[model samples]
Target chain A: MDEIIRTENLSKQYGELLAVSDMSLNVRKGEIYGFLGLNGAGKTTTIRMLLGMIRPTSGSAFIDGKRVFADNHELWKIIGSLVEIPYSYPNLTVYENLEIILRLRFISDKGSINRVIDKLKLSSYRNIKARNLSLGNAQRLGLAKALIHNPEILILDEPTNGLDPAGIYEIRELLKVMAEKLGVTIFISSHILGEISRFATRIGIIHEGRLIQEVDTSQLDKLCRKRLLIDARDKQAVYSSLMQSGYSLSETKDGRFELLDEKAVRNPEVIATLMVHAGCPPTLLHVEEEDLESYFLRTIGIKEDLR
Target chain B: MKNIKATLLPEFVKLRRSGIFWITIIIFIIIPLMMGLMMFVAKNPAIAAKLGLVGTKSSLFGRNDWPGFMGLLLQSLASIGYIGFGFVTSWVFGREFSDRTLKDILALPVTRSSIVISKFIVIVIWCILLILVLFSTGLLMGWLLDIPGLSVQLFLRFSEKYFITSFLTILICTPVAFFACYGRGIIAPIGFLIISLVMAQFAGLIGLGPYFPWAIPGVYTAPAGTEGMQLFLSSYVILALTCILGFAGTIAWWRYADHY
Candidate 1:
């Protein structure tokens, strides 16, 4: 019951291509588990398996301690999902599209459609046909459909694909509140690491159809490499001074001296004092931590420069 | 039953909003009107001669009376129904793939089996409405033309054969549903439909119409005692089996296949 969603060695193969390979992961109750991967990195495939939209080549996925399968209608009762680019019956109005989901989800309250529309800020476009709505509004309609039932678990795949910055922020805040206030378990996949890192309690990075890393969002700072960058009026003198002092250093492309030594990064004041004493006071002496994007790329065995 | 209703309601809503629904209605009505016009021309040889090729083609009905008109309508149902009903079936099932909405319904609280069954039910109901439109319009047109030889017995017999022929034609649409899922779009099922229509013609020409599901409905429309057009009990059995297989195959694909 604590583990709202679990996948055990779940994989999918399409002839010679392995779409998902031995992917084992879990999302606990009220936790926003952000699944991160590059495009074609099996994020959607894994999500499809998790939702029982596609069968796994091996292993299984479970929700609320029940196995996932097509006929397990009961299992889908507590789950609301938006997979990939969400689409609806093009000719149906946004209200009608959500109504279809409301009925199909077996909700007795007819007012649920209006409530979700209002919540997703789709009230203005309620009468607009799905095909006629702009990409941002279409995405909102998709989210409204997923949220119409107010299920306990939500599986969203790139749910913010076509949203404007404001729209993205609104959706992110809504998801955060859902997870925090209502205890809704969210399993979200996105290629946007910085965005996911903001609200996700835990993050799993998938690459080449395999999950390569899983770390708490809070621990990302520790996991990501940090360095002290120093630029001075007298660069050669400062470089010599740092090397003579036995501090490991490297040169950045912008001609700044980088010190990866923990002592230099943790106690930048010490490096500053050294620079002052060496007759080459630092113009820029700042400790810079590797961002989530860089860390993700590095974890996937790809150089940041290459990316 | 609740789940079926839940799934069926959406199917009807989608169908109602689609332009194709009204387009099919107009096509059905126009077909009977065209048939009526042809009957009127055949009834007047002087006008028929002045009309040229269309006049000569109207003679294919064999007579200008009510019986000839009813017979042509039944035959038209067999062939046109295959295309019309098949189009409805293709749109019902194939639009899910073409519109990229299949994934939205795959893991819903309502079972996939219920969704598939509801689609078929919608197709059946829609196709039946088209049949009624064709039959009613044909009746109106015949009355307006006053081609003569109208009798109560003949009307009842035509009604019976027309409905049976419509049912047989609709039954074969299940395979089109299967192809829609298998091919994942409308084009494949329609391709399958056209090819089957051609094959049905060849099957009837080769005296094997009774054994072919698509040809059986056409054979049923032929006048009784017509050589090589007679239907056996086995013909009904063959059509029923093909229908059951297609229905089961569609449900199986919905339940077991890995939908992307």
Candidate 2:
């Protein structure tokens, strides 16, 4: 893959607390890399390090094969970012706020501001002061600022934070188009696992200030634990019959037998036949696939029941 | 240079929209009008007697003429300029942290040094404009009062001293900018300003005013031969060093510190 953003063992320690540790990841060009983590799991810290806002205690980060540094003015020209909950100069209008970014980015085309406002659907709120803007519109303004310069790489931390469902979907589709059509590489951080799995080309889960697991979105289904669930009118007979057939089973909280065996999960009909012959017809039999949320929690060593 | 210019445009835009900016300008304008009222009271004993407290306060102006009025203006600028200019610097730099807008500019194509310099430039311009407003208003008030002992030479001399006092006072605001960045908000820097003002007073009482950056401007405002208020060549040097250090410190903080 053509790497656009890369971190090699990037670590940041604040006093005694390790905010981010040994984080190594790569985001390819035109790929939306989702950085998923629970709150306080080093998502923002890692993003800060990647943006060269916070220096790492050890190792380093790179953009387009160049080392990241706070004073590297040229490096930031091609990057746009929103670290956390985005904030703007509250006294400034949406158009004025975007204009600030456009000027700072040294963008010659003044029309870029209007283009971004229209892109984010913020035309109606163009003259409204940022403090008077709704949280959702404020978030849209933040996104508009990030997209104003048409950066090649975007680093966003919870970009959909204060947005409504429709706003979130709009931003998601916009990012998708930016990645697919404009070839803009994005490294987005969020705690929303299910939401990330929807558009992210690949996802990395961080836990306890460490990158715990990294997998492509397509591989998530194969990695997520799937099981065969069977419940019958007579649970005792079904249990005995499964045990006698040398099949391993575990009981769910609702008194259903769960089979982790690949054959049983792949062919639920076989188990149905066995249950029927045992004179205990299965009232419910289906394969249950763990969702991305559960998989994310499990990968982070947090049990759903405990949570 | 180009980066600083690019950053300055946004800084000016922000300053133009800020409520505090307008409030500071209004306060600066009002201060001279109030001074003129005091001078007017001093010029008339009849009204001064009727208003006892106001009379006694205006009576402190022994000469009550053009030179005296100009000297009073310089003294007030030395003190008020310190606080007012410090407030402007605090708001300019500290609002970024208070409003949580620092991160937006941190990773921009414009250099952090450029941003810091632009903020300082805006602050200097703001403070100078306030001083100009106060001076112009004070001059108009003095002309209306028609106090005696007015001369072309006295006006030029006093104007030069007034501007020098204003310049010295404005130079000290750099340290306030440092505190704004180091303390990460307006309150800490304003607190720092208050403490410095108090310390400047104490330094003057102890006959060490010339050595302190905050007091040097006030010491300069005193009469040339005033005892214990005489400023040496080293006083200017110390003030300049303090200004440089403060400017360097703020820039370094922006360029190197972990904003998070």
Candidate 3:
């Protein structure tokens, strides 16, 4: 598998604070790689370094076999990026904004410009100046500008930030289309974990300026921590039965029991039977699976004080 | 050439939208027409004889032709226009950073040098158009006045003098061009013009005004043939230094200055 983006000991510092510290990662070609992190987790700093917007303090990154900052001219030709907030000339209309960029790219072909406009569904709003457009529309325009050059690699930081549900869905579909149909490698930084789970084929989680883990999306099931939650007639009997069975269990305030051990809590019905034999269960026996949220929390080593 | 074209197309489009081009034409045409009307008002024999315009001063002030007055007006306008050029040049780069258009511009495949060079080219073009409009205005006003053989002579002579004068303005205005790019606000560039003026005045007091960038315009305005080639050469030297400094300042800022 060819790595489209590779960082070797890449680090960034602002005065005494380390934004990204000795971090390294690889993004394979033709994959939607999710860069997941909390607020101020150095995702933007890493992306800035990758795009050659900010120089790394200690190390380096490469895109398509060229050093990022050293060979920016060559690297920029293949990579399109939207760093933080997307910005363009406020006075220029959507068409005018794109027209200026198209002219700058030396692409005078009217057909090609029209094609990008149509692809982004910005045809009707083409004449409207960017300042008058709402945030969602501006975001679409930003995405349109990034896609205008048709670069093979996209480094989009918080691409879906501040978007409505429909706009978010549209962006998700656009990313899917770009990755699946166009074979463009997408490196996205987003706080929307559910959307990232749905869209990303590979995810790298960063915390405290370090990459904690990189996992395949399919293995997310194994990464999940499911619970065999038991709600039985006899709460004490159910707890004692599960505890004697060597299953790690936790109790909730509402007289329910939580089986924390993943391997030990496989068969909820068998536990229910064992409770019945022990004269406990006459009503409910349920199992609930852990979601990506819990998995991320665990991977980041944050203990859930579910009190 | 392709890079120049790529850069120029956007700048031309910007000028068109900003209405700076049409505005220049209107001001150039209107200023002279107003002077011609004033000339008509002051044409009576008693008024003309009062200013001692009846004899040798005719070549300098003209009997009835507005070209001479228009030339004088343009000299003032050109000096002022020199500062205007700085504002326009500054806006070319300043607006990009202030309004956050630099990101879109840098993301394109064009080199960074092209962006800066193209704006410099546009400022130079604006200077050329300004000279043309002023000259044409003088010619039109001269035709209206019917100054007995003074029409064509004043038109050509004043045009030639203003043409030479505008070059010195371009040179003296070069530092303002650099200042415009470096300054973040409208007041900063205006402050630069003030500083340039002060520096030129001080230099003049010390007998070094000929070498200062701000003194080039006044150098050309030094009544034709008094100093002639000496004035031209001295102004040219200062202009060369201004160009070198402008280019150096522009390249340095474009490469390293971060847009906040």
Q: Give the candidate number with the greatest TM-score.
A: 2
Range of the 10 consecutive residues with the lowest summed lDDT in candidate 3 chain A:
A69-78
How many times do residue backbones clash in model 2? 0
Which residue runs does candidate 2 get wrong by more than 4 Å?
A304-307
Whole-model lDDT, model 2? 0.92
Off by over 4 Å in 1: A231-240, A254-256, A275-284, A304-307
TM-score of each candidate structure, all chains considered together: 0.96, 0.98, 0.81
Looking at model 1 chain A, which ten-residue stretch has the lowest summed lDDT? Answer: A298-307
Point out where model 3 deviates above 4 Å: A70-72, A90-92, A161-163, A229-241, A251-257, A273-286, A293-307, B20-71, B138-161, B172-208, B223-238, B257-260
Q: Which residue pairs collide in model 2, if any? A: none
lDDT score at residue B255, model 1, on the 0-100 scale? 89
lDDT score, candidate 1: 0.92
Q: Residues A119-178, candidate 3, lDDT per residue (tens digit)?
A: 877889999988888877787788877878788999998887768998788889989998
lDDT of each: 0.92, 0.92, 0.73
Ranking of predictions according to DockQ: 2, 1, 3
